[model samples]
Target chain A: MTTPAMMYVHDWRAWQPGRRDTSQPRLSVAEKPAGGHVPAMLRRRLTGIGRALCDMLAELDVDADCPLLYASRHGDGERTLEMLDSLAEEAPLSPARFGLSVHNAIPGVYSIGRGNRRTQQAIAASGDEFAALLVEARGYLAQGEPAVIVAFAEQAIPARFTAHFTTPVDTAAVALRVSLTPAQDAWALTPRPLTSDDTAESRPQPSDLIDWLCGIRDELHCHRPRQAWSLVRAE
Target chain B: MTSELEQELKHLIIDTLELEDVTPEDIDPDEPLFVEGLGLDSIDALELGLALQKRYGIKLEADSDETRHHFRNLRTLAALVEERRTA
Candidate 1:
């Protein structure tokens, strides 16, 4: 018999920087990353998204070597825009800019800076990326990994592409330390395949995870379009 | 005239590249900008190019092989800007 998926969300943190207003479509991030907690060499090289990701990673309670998975709907939109601008202007693209424009750039920098050689994944999905991350985290728990960290950071779409999205996105990141061992007040997550009846209203927000982390919500049912993932408070 | 442009170039490099720890006086006029001397990489070079274009109204040819030679050091960069400045 196969062991059922059992995982405990040990700790989580949320950091949202920049103006809350989504009308202004410019890239804004925290002026300083974790108040310089990140090493200067790495910090200097990091883009705004990378800095935000590192800041969220610093707030995580997990070990430095823990496996990490990062998810986002739009990862490094500013850098990507800059690359496009360079291309349009017929300018040579900088090697460093191209390197940081990749979706996995933040995790790769974190791995190298902390000397972590474990496996890491960068995920990008159309909608409800946070839900996808939770589902992925549960899968990791099923494989007997002691713990995993899922960090997500994304910003508002650039002004050029604002027409493409209906929801006003903001610059935010959430880091969850999902563990195998259940502790007091841990939320147990069980994911089931979704049916047609389950709609978009059940979709999870970044704030929902924050509410669960802060003990405000007893349970959270994070849903994707066709995924019926649910989290319940362990009794 | 050359020394003044070189000094101005040094300050521009420090400001535009965000070399927080280094000062204008710290960068040598003849030191290589990449790999060994000032430790700037290709991104810095691109940013510096843009800044120079904005400040000095200079045009940089991306396909020109001589562009790399101009970016070799602060002195070379200042000379190129001086020679090419339209405004």
Candidate 2:
């Protein structure tokens, strides 16, 4: 039997390079890399994907003590590529780039921006990133965390590594505040088994995915190499 | 040393660290650049060292007090650049 919704979504925001904030007036890409939360010192050093993630974060009104979960299929690809290139050239690697190339780098920066020291986790499960993140959320809610902020993003692979990836990697970032007992309608995840008709690689682009998250879409099913789950809108 | 070299060093520091709000004039040569004046942390120290190495071909004694002395401020950094730069 499908279990009850393990968690609820309180609020969410999804960001793209040229996308506009419907809540605010027109803001150019140049104008929206970071909001007032990120200081100039930190903002100046953000990569493009980092910028998108930070911009999405600024829209979230999370508590100072709220836990955070950052999930990405490929984390910090550009910075990792730069460090690799530096190593190949036998040159000293940029310390900043090296430090930011780690999986939890952007979330660490966000913690600094918000002075948040709550329990934080970063996940990089191959194709089931979001699903696995929700599983973590379910754990947090089960353990009595009032809420958890979920941040997910993926950027285009660097030119040298583009040929390694078969699918067109779309750049996007999404932030969501999930709680156990939310004021709004809650969502549930039902574990599913993969089928021959599985459309894993051919999933909708990020923009459409964001729209699906916002609106009432059909059951969103995602399958990894070894596992699968269906996100259902349980009313 | 000429003021021009010190000014160049200031610009280098600002650019390398991505200190968006600070201008060369804002950084006092005598003030501590770490933890007090410019408020740079340990990561900034390593980043600055790497930038100096890339731009000037200068190698730092990674754990030496002498290296720390050279990174004292703008004047000290420029002095190291003047003495050690190959490019």
Candidate 3:
């Protein structure tokens, strides 16, 4: 079941710095993403990736019970790195930061705040997360659910890794709700696996994925370590 | 009247927990810090404990009744700091 059925894009939101698209309605998440409904206590714990995802998810007006698929290339790396640094220094680590140092911690905290009881999956599939999320979301849609929310977030990399960033929109997120029924746009996908030699070590950025979802691209090619997909606009 | 140490503890609580819009004048010395007046949770309790250890070199036994009593309110917490603080 590599290929999912024809998928429809219901709604989407993208946030980044210096993105002034006059065509769309203005949102307050231009530079700093406010964890819209997240309370102050929990909101302070959100990293840059969590901030973008939270803002986009809240703006989409998604139901609390809806399944969530959070995809990130680097998941909570800051928290992990900070703990590593603390251990290296023989210093005490803050218990709160330790609790939020997992790939799923942001969403886990989110579920607690909203009291949401739904299947939530967090993925760290390098650059292949876009395609990976599509497959997971497609499976959720196949289950007869009206829609599922798919979010891709990338935190700002350190200065040493700035040379590795391919897109200007490195610290940003794009979230979309998808279903089986036709909507403003749709995607016809032919999913295929990529060999280890071709692009296994690639950390392809999410800027292209953002463009493709915003209808800026009629067709797009995406590559992941395990799978690649030829995505064509179906509608 | 709140003691001078209690005033310091209120500021520390706000700064450490990142409690927005709360001020030293707003926190009552006798009010509970968790599940009540301030509505702080267990995580906040752990965070405040760490902050106290780092700032004043005072540590508490984990989940002990004595620890819970000392952490009951800002007034009691300040009392613990006043008695145990080494730095």
Candidate 4:
């Protein structure tokens, strides 16, 4: 019997900084005005960085109908900072802010916006967020449901917390749309580290891996950030 | 002329609202308090109202149309607080 199919992919920066490939550019925070088509209530508190990620997923055709697995290394750092700052000053926390400060808020918002009721898994690991998510997606694939995995990582944090970890200069979001089809481009499930290096010697970062899969680039070098994850056909 | 009342009000706004990007001086007395102004939402109104009652010993009548008028802006909120403080 053929092994079940599992795919891993990534999308970095929703909107392009300049004219580039087919990857759609991300929208600015200011662009997300009140009552926009994007489920405004669910996303009002998201920072520009967070909103950029949601926009990227929406652009990639991630709808509520699809099963999704969302993984984030450091989820909602800005909200965490705000809450901690208020608590430190002996100020009453804003209820709205407190509600959205949870680690699952990113996936929660995306699910609500897309009206997706499918099972969604949200996880935050010390450094194995990507690996953990890939394993989860494999589980779904084994269960016989096509899985769409979105893995995102953002390094923007308050300096108080930044001093503890390696400072990430940029942010990224990557998504993959995976399904079983009669094609040879299926991705094999493998456990590995989340690396920033894109060299062939080093395993490709999620973003570079998707780029290579899409044939956008032959290879990506080290230092390129990896973002969201998804499944795509190998051409 | 920073009266104790004004200072109290400023402290209340800063503390109750959790306005991180805002300081007491940054809030203009006449600025609209919601939407185009400080961008406070409906949830903020509820929490601020609760704080006002507990901290200032003022019972803001929920049904009164005056409640909306009183919460229109900081100046109005301050006026209500001043009126209640004296009474």
lDDT values for all models: 0.72, 0.74, 0.75, 0.60
Ordered from best to worst lDDT, the candidate numbers read 3, 2, 1, 4
TM-score comparison, 1 vs 4, better candidate: 1
Which order, best to worst by DockQ? 2, 3, 1, 4
Candidate 1's C-alpha runs over 4 A off are: A1-5, A18-35, A45-49, A59-63, A89-95, A192-197, A215-217, A227-235, B30-32, B35-37, B42-87
User: Per-residue lDDT for A1-235 in model 3, tens only?
Assistant: 5675457766777766555553655233466666767877678777655666666776664467778898887776567777898999999888888888878887787777676788899998756888788879988888888878887777667665467665443666777777787744554455555555455434445556565655677656556544368999998
RMSD to native for every prediction? Answer: 8.2, 6.2, 6.7, 10.3
- What's model 3's lDDT at A131? 73
Give the per-residue lDDT of model 2 (tens digit) for B1-87.
Answer: 338888888888888888878988789998888888888878889988888887899989776899889988878888899999998
User: Which CAPRI quality tier does the interface of model 3 achieve?
Assistant: medium
Docking class of 1: acceptable
Which candidate leads the pack in DockQ?
2
Estimated TM-score for each candidate: 0.73, 0.84, 0.85, 0.58
Residue pairs with backbone overlap in model 1: none
Model with the higher DockQ, candidate 3 or 4: 3
lDDT of 4 at B61: 72
Q: What is the clash tally of candidate 1? A: 0
The whole-model C-alpha lDDT of candidate 4 against the native structure comes to 0.60
